[model samples]
Target: MRQSPALRILAGTALALLLGVSFTQAASSTKAAAPESSESFDYGTVDSFAGAFLAARTAEADRDYPNAIQFYKKALDFSPNELELQQRLMIALFMNGDFDEGAKLAKLLEKDPAVERVTSVALSFQAIRDGSYAKAMKSLKYEGPNDLDRLMNELLTAWTKVGEGKGKEALKQLQDLKGPSWYSIFTNYNIGAIASVVGDEDGARKAFTETVTDKNGGATAPDTYARAVMALATLEANAGNKQKALDALSAGDELITNFAPFKALRDEIEAGRKPKPVIETAAQGAAGVLFSIGGALNRDGAEDTVMLYLQFSRALDKEAADTLILLGGIAEKAGQPNKAIEFYRQVPETSPMRRISELQLGLTLAETGKVDEARAHLQKLIASDPKDVRSYLAYGSVLSDAKDYAAMAANYDKAVEVIGPAPTRNHWSVFFQRGIAYERLKKWDKAEPDFNKALELNPDQPQVLNYLGYSWVDMNRNLQQGLDMIKKAVELRPDDGYIVDSLGWAYYRMGRFDEAVTELERAIELKAGDATINDHLGDAYWRVGRKLEATFQWKRALASEPEEAQVPAIQAKIEKGLPPIEADAAKVNAEPAAEPKKDDKKT
Candidate 1:
């Protein structure tokens, strides 16, 4: 999905060709001049091509992307030597997701001596996207002096070595390129990634810290800082430095308050996934080149190193408001709820995403038992942004948790009022949450209507299916429909022990005792500690006439603290004669089949 610069060039070339064709058509018709004589296309084609190309530009300005793309392609067809058109086409291809074709064109365009350094840099990116790191490095040889490409090339080349699993080689390459440059922060981060790849935790830790500290004041200093902090956190965690890991996690959480670029990296690390290998301090470098060179490292699943790098990235820039919101998210993911709240509070009242962050942080705080504080935050966000539906939803959840049923309903109503009509998934959650509150308040009529509404908005959501089914069963009404609903729920959540148990109970209620045993056994296998499932299995065994086995299961169930009133019935069952059980001769003879895992009790 991430388009590389190469694809951009291809798209640009395609568009330029379209523009050139249009130019030639117009010129040939009006000027009435030339017939082809085996020579290369007439120089007059540039005039026509340039005219049509300009018109295409206007079309692009009007948001007519397809039209623009066509005209640009025509222009290029007339004047293949047009560097500007080629560059534009490439940009278009990347934007349009035609990376493969774009990359091919980029390689051809980069061979042109007329292309500028910036254009060549773009071509380098194309090579990276094409999964040709060696080619990207090769293209950089043509890059002009005193430009950003040299540093970028060095960083990418080193990363390529790392991806090839030659960590020592990568380190040496990186060290060779280390010096005063606009890419210092980025270069250092590459060093850290390389160190971590080679299992040099101490070196990686030091490198990451230096990069994040921003002592060099490089353009990408902030990004490097954030990346370094995050990398260090993950490294500490991986090395069992729990305390330091926690501290680094805390710092990374604080950094997102002002740096948005690093947010995704922070998230990936927090999720126990590796961040993409990035040249942490990127003032400007070829896109996709780093990805290509570090493709192997990226796929190496170095989650710990990536996490540290992400944390460092989180601290890179401190002036952007979006950055702070990113920090809030990182904090929440890293299990620092209080810090998440602190970051969320950094969003000013007028910011659109402020309400969103507030809602998320409030819910997180509430879950962490800071209920009052969470509620206050939600109320504040709602007060400032009364039209925001998410804030209302968060408020309702908080009120529901606090057992304030009336307030919960009011908040949900406010959410519905603000959101008007929307898609099913978006509309259903509020209704479902409100329905739960109504059910808790013992207002069944109100709750049923809301549940029905939720189902109408998003049909067959498993949670709704299960709740409605279980409620009907508990009420001893609509037994057949309840079974159908629970069956549907089970299909949706096949691995859920609780849902499976409900199905078993429904079969038992239908007096299909044999059928009940099958599902009950599966439920027990899924949830070995479930008391209700154990008892249900015992009862089903009894009804199936497996008297001895039934009594034994009942005794086992009783021993596991069965309900007080049920103990007497179990005692009576133990005293009564039991039906015969089939002998497991294989187990008695120490057969190999006896080695089946206990949970495999349910085929």
Candidate 2:
């Protein structure tokens, strides 16, 4: 809230706390992991400074931090005193986890106010890592990039007090802390953690209760809120209040559906196991201070700053599983799947997050085009625990990415068997995914009932509605009901281009050419340059006699690179046009498709 892209990030820093933004939020990211173009571009061949600078910028945009760092160093070598170049290099270094180099550069730039927010943070992290708590606080001076930055500084400054063994002072600072109402969850949570670290059990419990009960702030930042619940529950468990700990976890579950860490903790407590307190030392408390604000800034376009904060957080507490996992997610978002793999590999095997990290590692491997390796990894994971729906679902996803629908369907079948036919609301996705697999294999009878079952479990799910409705319309059955379902899906996800395209395509199937054209245009607007959507628009244009524009659209579709199997048909449409609009029993060969998703989207 109160921040710029950079200013907002610097101002409002919090931790991913390993509680992570909801997995649901992570699934909704706009930037999907994409394969960065790896054409052999030799930076050494670039003779000019401008050429090197441009190369650095391009690599940075593609999230190729290693190359970006190299190119930027080359650019700075050519123009050593360029202030902006130094600033950019510092950020690139931090994002790549080159903290020593970043620290050196921070010293070089610390006197310049323009880069103060980042430089101050870098310097403070260096001091903290060196165990110079007094120096760390002294280095943490610059404050105003925005309210978020100032608030983060306030929290970090308080943690520095804890580092100096001034625990009571840190608690007092938090008690008097004030900012946006959103700050309450982080503020109170950290107060509790600090108190817990210093052996003030009653004080810790009080602050944590304040955090867990702050539903409004918790709703605003659920990941931070989740961390608060875990902290409070851990405190209770350590104090021998097992039932209280379980109750807290149950409440957290109700707030955050299917969150793995909470479940992991809840199971431990249920089995008469005690969870250690979340914050055990001054440094861990300080790391939470950074994570509390840093993690809140994990949105699109702020990866650079989030990376900086998280790296610094890790420097404070090397065993911070949440910090490491979040860094992996950021790398994935930045289109650096290999870099993500490195972070995932760094997560301690003993941490509760190790399982999730391994799953992510397998997924990231698939993103790097190691499909076979990914399959073997996830398959072994599934074999490790047949009763784990998560393992099966993850395995099925890898197969789906490979377009091995037969295997995907089989994966779900095994999941269904393990689940014992009593599909609950959480199992809706299993049924839905299975239906899609069967649909791809042209087993309509099998696919239909599964789709129906998914809807029965979670009616109003937009993806299910769009797919089933569009299929019915394409087959010329249940025409009105299909159209209504598609329309409802559109209303539910008005901004989703794929659902909109399904509605438009259904209209084309019904021979409502003009209506088809209108809906297709809207779909085109939502998802520009999509080959399938462009092709559909072209077909609608031809049906409505916009012949010239129709040819333009077909050409556009071809340029966007339709699937290789569809290339020949698209070229023929451009050259000879669509077959005369005629009634035929033979269906058009475009297999029914639900909206194709960008993998691992995070919000």
Among all candidates shown, the one with the greatest TM-score: 2
- TM-score, structure 2 vs. true: 0.90
Q: Please list the residue runs of candidate 1 whose C-alpha ends up more than 4 Å from where it truly belongs after superposition.
A: 1-306, 318-352, 420-425, 527-603
- Give the C-alpha miss distance for residue 393 in model 2, angstroms: 1.5
In order, candidate lDDTs are: 0.57, 0.78
- Per-residue CA lDDT of candidate 1, range 307-406, in tens? 2222222222222334455545544554566766776676665443444566677887886898998789889978976765556766876786677988
TM per candidate: 0.42, 0.90
Q: What is the C-alpha lDDT profile of model 2 across 1-603, one tens digit per residue?
A: 223244343433432221121223322332333224423458678665666676776677676778878877887788898777787787778767788898899999998766777778788878877789999898877545456666777778887888888889988987897776667777888888888888889998898888888877676667678888988898898789998898888878777776767767877778887776667877777677667666766677666667777877776777777788888998888777888899889988766567788788888888899999999998887787677787777777788888899999999999999989577887888888899889988898999999999999999998889989999998888988999999999999999988899999989988898999999999999999999999999999998889899999999999998888878888998999877766332555555776348542111
Best by lDDT: 2
Give the Cα error of residue 569 in candidate 2, in Å: 3.0
Q: Which stretch of 10 consecutive residues in model 1 shows the poorest summed lDDT? A: 589-598
